[model samples]
Target: TKEHLISVEQGKQYMPTDTTQNSLLNLDLLENSEFSSITRRQFISKWYSFSYWIIFAIIIISYLVYFILSKRSVNPIEIRRRKSTKIAIKRLKNARFCLKNRDFDQFFEEIEKSLWGYFADKFKINSSELSKETIDLYFDKRNIKTETKNNFVSLLNICEFARYSPSKDRNLQMERTLEEAKEIIIEVESDIKKK
Candidate 1:
């Protein structure tokens, strides 16, 4: 009641420079006191934006983990095929060296070994248990021409016979056998590529 009874002279002198009052006014403006509340649409938009970011982060993290695991994964069949091919190539090189030295016995042995090694690699078969008949049957089953399979078989048989028989012209036999083996390897390589 006394505050309401202030005279015009007293009202004119009511200039209180309180720092606490100024600070409170600044706080009120910072808090947007003029706005009573956020609208429903504004609230939903903010929530959706936050959730979108969270989902995107989860998707990115999941893909990164999947990529890391895929990079480390190895196929067993591919590993075996690579190992066998490497061994086959090495054996072929050894056979060529034996041929160059005119060591008919070693040449025949290496050729036979290399041929079987190539077959084992091409078909992913056990080299130790392989036979000419089995190899021919495999090639036949795969729709390989009879002529090609017979040539490969005959070459293998020649190498075996040359290795055991006491032949006078062993060097000539080695040359023929080496050529035949080379042809078989080339054919097999082409066949494998086709498959």
Candidate 2:
């Protein structure tokens, strides 16, 4: 009886099955030439669309990486501070050389420039707007002593006067002025640290 039952099942296995009923081996789409062509075109179009989107995504990701890297390398405040300090020191050294060579006009001019450049860099003050009153107001707000503010302003005024007047006594005042200017910068730097 079992042998007969197995033979009947084997016979059913040899019978033809409906093409559309089997999802894995369905051939209806291929049998229709127009439908197969349309499906191939749709697949190609979808491939092109997916490729375009992938390219766009890659571009956006690269830009995001570039933006992050650029931002990571920059620190505006530290850059400004370092550059200003270097320039100020170089100018001061040049002024000292001028003093040693008895170049009064150049020495005064360098000192004035160093002070103005320092203020402009440190406070974002415009060069054209750098005046004694502006310096006084800025230093006063920072809690710098009245005497220190007066001394800085007075030094600037002296530089301006000596630049134009060509006084004979400028040589005598050069060393003292340089020292006072150095002291002013040191005091201001220390005050900034305290803040």
Candidate 3:
């Protein structure tokens, strides 16, 4: 009876509005016109903005490698000792060659040079200031053996005399001097180890 009694205009007024359809239309509009999602390729193409950071990181890594390599890791004393030993051995070899060839002038010169050079490198002393007194004082302080000290001092004197004196027997003294030099180096090295 109620359905039959209602009029067309009154029924239209009583019906509720369709809110779901309106909300769906709004979502579609937003997706199409207001906001959009980017693809992976589009995001990756904007690499120019980050290129500076990549270059900076590479430079930092290179400098770190250089620093690590350039830093000295060996003990200073050991470095000095090794360098002195190498130079002395090389000079001794040269002196031996000179002796074999009967070149006494060069032989004495090489021996003297080697001794002075070793002292210079070992004590960080200047070549001009490397005097007998300086070496004696250094050896004295280190408490080197008396025989080693005497052999070192005497060898220097002999080398100097052979260099300056005119009438020296070059061939006769070569073998003994060479042997003494080798012995002195060995003994001094052992004394250094003891200290």
Task: Specify the poorest-scoring 10-residue window by lDDT in model 3.
Answer: 34-43
Task: Write out the backbone clash pairs for model 2.
Answer: none
Superior by lDDT: candidate 2 or candidate 3: 2
lDDT of every predicted structure (CA atoms): 0.76, 0.81, 0.79
Which should have the higher lDDT, number 1 or number 3?
Answer: 3
Residues 123-170, candidate 1, lDDT per residue (tens digit)?
777767699878877897776767778888888888888878948977
Instruction: Encode model 2's per-residue lDDT on 1-195: one tens digit a residue.
Output: 355444334564587877668864446647565658778889899999999999999999999999987886697765666577677778899999999999988999999998888777776677789887888888878887777777778888888988888766777789888887788777777776677
Q: What does candidate 3's lDDT look like per residue over 1-195, in tens digits? A: 355665555554586769998899987776786333453445555675478788999999999988876654446665665689688878989999999999888988888888877777776777888898987888888888877888898998988887778345668787777777777777777887799
Instruction: List candidate 3 stretches off by more than 4 Å.
Output: 1-69, 73-81, 166-169
Off by over 4 Å in 1: 1-77, 82-86
**Strongest candidate by lDDT:** 2
TM-score of each model, paired residue for residue: 0.57, 0.58, 0.59
Candidate 1 clashing pairs, residues 3+ apart or interchain: none
Report the alpha-carbon TM-score of model 1 versus the true structure: 0.57
